[model samples]
Target: MNSLTHSSTSVVRKASRFLLTSRRFCDTSRINGDEETLKITWETSEMDCGFAEEHEKISVRRTFLESTKLSASQVLDTLKQDCPGFNTKLALDELNVPISGLLVREVLLGILRRLSFDNKTRCAKLAYKFFVWCGGQESFRHTANCYHLLMKIFAECGEYKAMCRLVDEMIKDGYPTTARTFNLLICTCGEAGLAREVVEQFIKSKTFNYRPFKHSYNAILHSLLGVKHYKLIEWVYEQMLEDGFSPDLLSYNVVMFASFRLGKTDKLYRLLDEMVKDGFSPDLHTYNILLHHLATGNKPLAALNLLNHMREVGVEPSVIHFTTLIDGLSRAGKLEACKYFMDEMVKAGCTPDVVCYTVVITGYISGGELEKAEEMFREMTVKGQLPNVFTYNSMIRGFCMAGKFKEARLLLKEMESRGCNPNFVVYSTLVNNLRNAGKLLEAHEVVKDMVEKGHYVHLISKFKKYTRS
Candidate 1:
């Protein structure tokens, strides 16, 4: 409400103007890596959990690899072997059996991460029956985490009816439907590809008698934001208040983050004002979200200005704040400013991490300053900041763009040597460059390598099918 706050409002509002181009977020790379590639799912959000940041294609594929050591069924079998009478004890009523609930449940859940999709589907029934039996015992109490694991399996299998039955049982057994339960369930909605249907199913549960806790509604709202379901996020938030749960600090942060995500600056300011009125102060995370939005909006000056206000308000600025400013400056063609902040960041006693280096490198590449990008990349390795796949991919793309195919090829091998696999983006860039340069044989070889690495290469597939026809 003072001069500092008034100026801050102008900074954010002006920065928000760039949100028109903000969805692409000042980087071509930020948009779905291979923009031409077909998507497999029908969900509106690009995120699986809707809230977690998207990983590279290589990392995503690695997540689907079946464990060579323990299949999901084998893991379940081992559970039965390890606890010989566990299920039997669970089935028996009026028996007080001391069970390591989390231990058993986590073991099963861990296997799901490793199991093939078919195996995961097969393991679902086994998991459901196990939980149903476990919940039946007087001594076999399932934790909220345990409920989430089962719900995840059910959501994955599209066994919505089973999930409904399980929730009903959960309520009847006095299991508290806290935020954790709803957070997991809402995340499952994204990961399981349920979209908005789970929201309806959750509301439908009201017919069964017990009400979901305030935290449950909060989780749903946050999860909606994770998927960029902007309108639904507000819809759920209002429903939460109408259902009588006053907005807590967490609730305000969720709505505020979603507001920035959709560039709804008016809504964001209102939420901030309302939070203060409700006796809830914005925390470090609230400021971080603001910093991120400001930076992404290409307002490096405003984002840096925000750190001054952060100091004024007694919230210490973090490495994330500095890195964000560096990224913004880099995108704005102010490489000198990026260096200035990188130096200023250390002067503030917060060390620059690998992510900081990567952002700067990306900016350099985008601006055609390949030499500086390479210099920073080497400095990162020398300083023991392990470069991730994104770091490597950026340099590779830069090399390909600059007609430095030899450098790109070497960097691809270097990344693999460091255990960072080249993703489809890297290969696609190389292949396109090679084809353009009339290196047909090399281009075809790279395409083959791409398909071997699990790219569908749908265009090539269509070509082959056409020839066959």
Candidate 2:
């Protein structure tokens, strides 16, 4: 065998040994601690998904409150009406209302939500003034949610310094800094394209005395992965090892993902070997990472072999495992192979979900196989898998790519008929493709529809720029 094959074989053997021996090294105390940390990790991840949803729900729930003597909406309106421009503090100081001790958590949150809706820094300042005013009240103390909300505003408005100050204040005030807070700071900063700053904050956590969780390094690394900061993740992993923190299964999976993302294949294998030697076994996430790397690296056979090995180790391959492989294959332009694996997924008793179908459809579309894309789209529907906004967007984009404007429009109508309302992407795809095809009138219609449907009304001005004489 070639050196690469030999090396791979050796890693596989070590992995096998690692998997078989991992149970023997399970320390009860450590396992309990790790489980609790893992629970926090899972909650943080769940919160990330539900963050926007929960925000919307909160806003909606308080939209029409019962007419109390002084309602939240009335207070918010008073603030907006009186606090014109940036003179929020001045306006609040002059207001002859007993605002202190009257505002509950819900009221405070509602007011903050209203202020944050515009997502302007000026608005954040107004929100912060109100927040400070409330804090100064003898009868009122900000809840953890209140601090998180205000911090979110600051982070969203790029007021990192203000956000950090708030974090320091939270710690100083002896509020329990939970995993949610840690995730919020990292994710919001990362989303704002300040991933490096997240890493910097994590590195400076000791300096700031900002250790939220016992597994702070792992939490930071995991949060960084969510934001796709592969290089930062690897750097943090290095820092973790330097700080004498042993790599857990999650840490290994995270660093392995980083290595895969960075294209450090050799280093990835070496890390696997090291993990095995360290008595860590490959979990489902580990297998998924390896599957993604192997398949996307155009080594489908090796990926399949790995899948077999996974089964041999009594690890059931989930739909996610199959989807990861299919996605990687699709990325590698192996559409046929993707289909083969899709079949294999079903044969292995895992039914393909909309995401799985979407990946394959997207693959066919990207490869310019529009007919195959259409076939798969139909097949998914026949299999009772309704195309989501993403699937519809993919098909619509495919249709537009082939200059089939009529078909794309029909698909848009079909999306609405099927209760899949076209989102910003679907509308933008149509407008852009129609405009590019010189169907200016059609593009204008799509934009008008988009505005009427309450999506990107501001895009009208931008669209006009391109359409102008």
Candidate 3:
């Protein structure tokens, strides 16, 4: 066969192989509900590939250069003016601006970015119309970035079905569905609080041959973890196993954290054992997860023993491991255990960072041991660990809780002098506490200071209402 014919045959063979594999997976997998979607995806892929091959044969002019009189900003403004309503198709038909390839990409991206901030459903509708209009242009082809931007806009507007349709359109256009694409979809869906939907989409993506990562299941799990959808993580992990995908280290760590967060302690230990049997040694993250679980479960001795086990396994605990243990202990009200681990962390040749010190300080403050909290604050400062905003906020809050308004005000100034700018939380802490303590005058002064410093000026009206009431 000729080279072109051979290449075409090879592509067909590959597509056929993909179809066969997908069928096998569908037949054996519990995702039988997606059988129709998988069939449609395969048929669409075959059709798109055939169309692409034919188009390549006939299309000789790949690049189009047109002199557009309008700038990108001008086109954007025109679209914004004409396409602000839901009748985007009518507005697009009326749009007479000349568009180049560069102009279309730039305008589409700009429009999406602007609309992302606005997050209006109308904006999504208008943007989609513009996207369709651009795709219809002879000189303009939708780039992956354009699709991604539009997808993100749709996601922000809570138009998830529209977003998934864009993915389908991308696939039909023969665009490589990359890891970035999958991650974007997962993250946006997670941000929309559609954790279960994220999993469903992931499974559907797999059926449609949208394999972005080498281990796509782990990628979805990791993204779910980013949004703290622990319950979904557990569910997805279980689905991953049922589909015969082996759990990697990342998978184990993610599921372990999910199990820990969900209080499935029995399942957590079982997975730990399974991990060892599977010949995967617990890394630092695994150790930290166990440390957190043990400390939070009020098993201080077990936590210490796990730290020893980590060292025995040649995985030396870092400051983060110690901090996790300490934070868990603090939450469990094991203040003395927190202190002991803080010391042990230093002796293990891992110097405590600011986070380590902050956790301990926050712990003491929460325990109502203001003296110990103050001592930690001073100790961290003296030991050259300059307090961060969180550290200062913890101290300021402790003072406010103890009704030491004067000292709290001094600490606020001290933080600024020490080159730490108080954040919204710091200012809010003072204002809310002072107002609650009936120190309306003091709270008003703080509000004025916050406004003068260009921090949360919008809160001024709310503070006024609080004071008046």
Q: Pick the candidate with the highest lDDT.
A: 2
Q: After superposition, how far is residue 168 of candidate 1 from its true place, in Å?
A: 4.2
lDDT string, candidate 2, 383-410, tens digits: 9999999999999999999999999999
- Candidate 2 achieves a global lDDT of 0.78
lDDT score for candidate 3 against the true structure: 0.76
Better of 1 and 2 by TM-score: 2
lDDT digits (tens) for residues 202-270 of candidate 3: 576643333544577877777778768888888888898899999977788899899999999778767
| Regions more than 4 Å wrong, model 1 | 1-194, 200-214, 225-228, 328-336, 421-469
Q: How many backbone clashes does candidate 2 have?
A: 0
Q: How many residue pairs of model 1 clash at the backbone?
A: 1
- 1-469, model 1: which lDDT tens digit per residue? 3654566668655323322555543564565845525443534355565545445555654643433223334445544433334553333322322334744465557645644545655567667655665666565677867876787777677676667577666777777565455555566555566646767666545432224425566657765676677767877788878878898887888888888878898888778778877777668777777777766665656677777767766778889878877776777677888888898898989988999999999999999999999999999899899999789888988888888988888887788788887766667667777777877777776667656667644445432212211
Q: Identify the superior model by lDDT, candidate 1 or candidate 2.
A: 2
After superposing all C-alphas onto the true structure, candidate 1 shows an RMSD in angstroms of 20.1
Q: Cα lDDT of all candidates, in order?
A: 0.68, 0.78, 0.76
Cα-based lDDT at residue 231, candidate 2: 86
Clash totals in order: 1, 0, 0
